[model samples]
Target: MTAPLQGKIAYVTGGSRGIGRASAIAFAEAGADVAICHLDDEAEARTLVQAVTARGRRGFQMAADMGEVAQINAFTAAAEAALGPCDILLNNAGMNIRNPFGEITEAEFDRMVAVHLKGMFFMAQAVYPGMVARGGGRIINIASQLALKGSPGIVTYCAVKAGIIGFTRALAHEAGPRGVLVNAIAPGPVETDLTRARGPEWKARISASLPLGRIGQPEEISATAVLLAGPGGSFYTGACLSPNGGDVMH
Candidate 1:
């Protein structure tokens, strides 16, 4: 049928797996060329690129750690060079260190902030100038349901995600006037490598707790990203869209 983002370009970080991978493909299917970067997983990244190209959209991939400013800059430059200036950006790259608050180390905390908050800041900075010059663009940041309602063991993660929401809202205030829309997505209990690491018992408990009585899939979350990137999200700036399976009803 008709493509909503036919002439657009999307940049997705941590696009080799989970939500990022699914979002990249969904964006391509919606008719945007996609550029993605991964920290390691070259094979998975390559496969994701193949999926994008198979959809008849241009695809670009590279290896870069979002936590490092140099790498983030390099990736943005390379991605824009290969796919042209980004029209949509999904800052989805991140990692978690789940433990009791008392057991959390300084190094672990630093890593979390570096990758989740700092990386998101610069990555958005890298594209903001162009989007402002071009008159508009969309930015979708990934937060977590925990950011709304905290989890016991993932204190740091919850805090960082909460920071993302604040960042999204504050950035929107500045960007909206200039035509760049910024927003955040807070998902609950999705099946990703991170969630899988939480173990089957944890999964069963989380699944049962959600009002939907099931865990979410990556594709389910990606649909939201597509909506935020396409014309449907034209007025969704600075908002936190939660596809949380009734996990955090507000």
Candidate 2:
């Protein structure tokens, strides 16, 4: 009956919906107070806050772009102010522009770097010092299976995700000994606004190609996060846990 994350505080980026939202609620259900940041989903963010409160957990939400350092810092300060110092950070805010290699624009490339690389890098920096000072914490970055296995038409996305894998592993070395654990989850095609935009044909085709004969759900991916952020994940650091329906086995 004891909650694994009881008395812990979790800060999640892009948590208004999908895997981030699911994990925020899951953390609360496991007894952690959650604070989330969204780009422009006040309605969804409000709904998520209410859901967390419904479960008798403190919830806080802020609207900010993860790509902007000023916004990331402000959001972090606000979240900690609302729920106390963060014990877990989910750098899950992300976006992708699925343009062909030849058609990828400078603007598009810049945005992807800003959101995925810079966003995650600074967000982790923001909370890591606090976590280490407190003697232990969790940092879970959302990566993609495509990072390991090459994919066409989303070259930039794949490149940046691969960068995340590198970042997670490198950070674990510096933070692990300091009592902060860093890891990543490289998920397969999942049901999200981004994936659904690919249409049913693409979905069905991709599903048939997977070893599991199906794509993944947000909760399924979030479950990996729950394990990483909970007591069970204490021994794991610098590890990449893939729940990608056997898309890329390692």
- Local accuracy of candidate 1 as per-residue lDDT tens digits, 130-240: 999999999999999889999898899999999999999999999999999999999988999988988999999989998999999999999999999998999999999
Model 2 clash count equals 0
lDDT of each: 0.95, 0.94
Please provide, for model 2 over 1-250, each residue's C-alpha lDDT reduced to its tens digit, 9 standing for 90 to 100: 9899999999999999999999999999999999999999999999999999999999999999999999999999999889899999999999988888999999999999999999999999999888888899999999999999989899999999999999999999998889899999999999998889889999999999999999999999889999999989999999999999988888
TM-score, model 1 to reference: 0.99
**Model 2 misplaced stretches (Cα beyond 4 Å):** none
Worst 10 residues of 2 by lDDT: 125-134
Indicate which candidate wins on lDDT: 1
Give per-candidate clash totals: 0, 0
Alpha-carbon deviation at 81 in model 2, angstroms = 1.0
